[model samples]
Target: MRFLLIEDNVQLASAIVERLSLDGHVVDLAPCLADARAHCATAEYDLILLDIMLPDGDGRTFLADHRGRENATPVIVLTARSEVSDRVGVLDLGADDYIVKPFDFSEFEARCRAVLRRKGGASGNRISRGDLKFDTLAGTLQVAGEQIQLRNRELRLFEIFINAPGQIFSKSKLVDRLFSYDEDVSENAIEVYVGRLRKHLSASAANIVTVRGLGYKLEV
Candidate 1:
């Protein structure tokens, strides 16, 4: 999954980004509200990890504005505020979940998965298409009950496609989703990953099909 982390705490943000990346999720960090808004305007994220006390403005304001625009992107407020009123305010503002500061990383990760599952209409960590199974939590792929190995980029590409099966994804969108802010990537890099992933999915019941001047979609 692709995520935007809006946290003013540089150390915390770095640690979270590293952990999420290790778990096979692409993450972009924003140290302030202005930067976060810029990221939101240009990119689509599966989730947003928002801190309440941003350098420029309260994260709640950003949440309100986002919901005001009728944007449905799931947001989990990560803040030092443990007050019931604070939590209620953000929840009423359409934040999907809330996490208090000095929390366990395991709990944080679990909450993230729960929110994503709820958003994707999935019940658990595994998402299936035909005979293929993707272990979202474990970052593994299985075809017909047999495990299939994929490179990091290939796995990331597969995750995006599998989660949104039958939906067309343009090359530009794919690039945005596959790479983080620091990576130097191009459209050709996306094509390379797709080509390799296609070969890996050869035995599966699902196939990735190009849409001819449009993009690619997963067919099952």
Candidate 2:
């Protein structure tokens, strides 16, 4: 998963980035709310790890602006503020979860995973289509209990398909989904990822079919 870490504490922010990177996440760190908002303008992040006391702006205001204008990107607030009201305030401001400073890294990671799982779906954090079950958070594709691991792009393509079910997703939209502002994506990149995911699915490829010149759609 690709994540954005909006934190001003250089030491703690580096530590968190290292930990998350070791756990198989591609992380981008921003020291202030301005940099974070700039990244948000074009980059697509799976989740955002935010700090309340930013150098340039308040995290609450940033969260409000984002929720009001953009896609509902899951956010977990990391702050030194430990008061009951502080926690309530952040949560009420649209944060997916809140964690106080001097926290256990293990628990923080667990909370991040839980928040992502809940936002994605149920059924044991899996997206099912007939005999296939894809564990999105774990990035595992299981066919009748046989597990298969997917590459980053392949998993991302599958994620889009599973999220919409039967709806048609245009190639342009898929390209936008697979790429961040930091990356240069061609129009055909979507087709490339879809082709790779189709090969990975084998017989299950029937579930994802082209919609002629329009794009692609997933059918149960």
lDDT (Cα atoms) of all candidates against the true structure: 0.89, 0.80
Q: Which stretches of candidate 2 lie over 4 Å from their true place?
A: 18-26, 68-71, 179-187
Q: For residues 137-178, could you state the per-residue lDDT of candidate 2 as single tens digits?
A: 688888666788987778767876876788898887676666
Best-fitting candidate, scored by TM-score: 1
Itemize residue pairs with steric clashes in candidate 1: none
- Model 1: per-residue lDDT, tens digit, 175-198? 888788788888999888888878
Query: How many clashing pairs per prediction, in order?
Result: 0, 0
RMSD of 2: 3.0
The candidate that wins on lDDT is 1
Task: Give residue 98's error in model 2 in angstroms.
Answer: 0.9
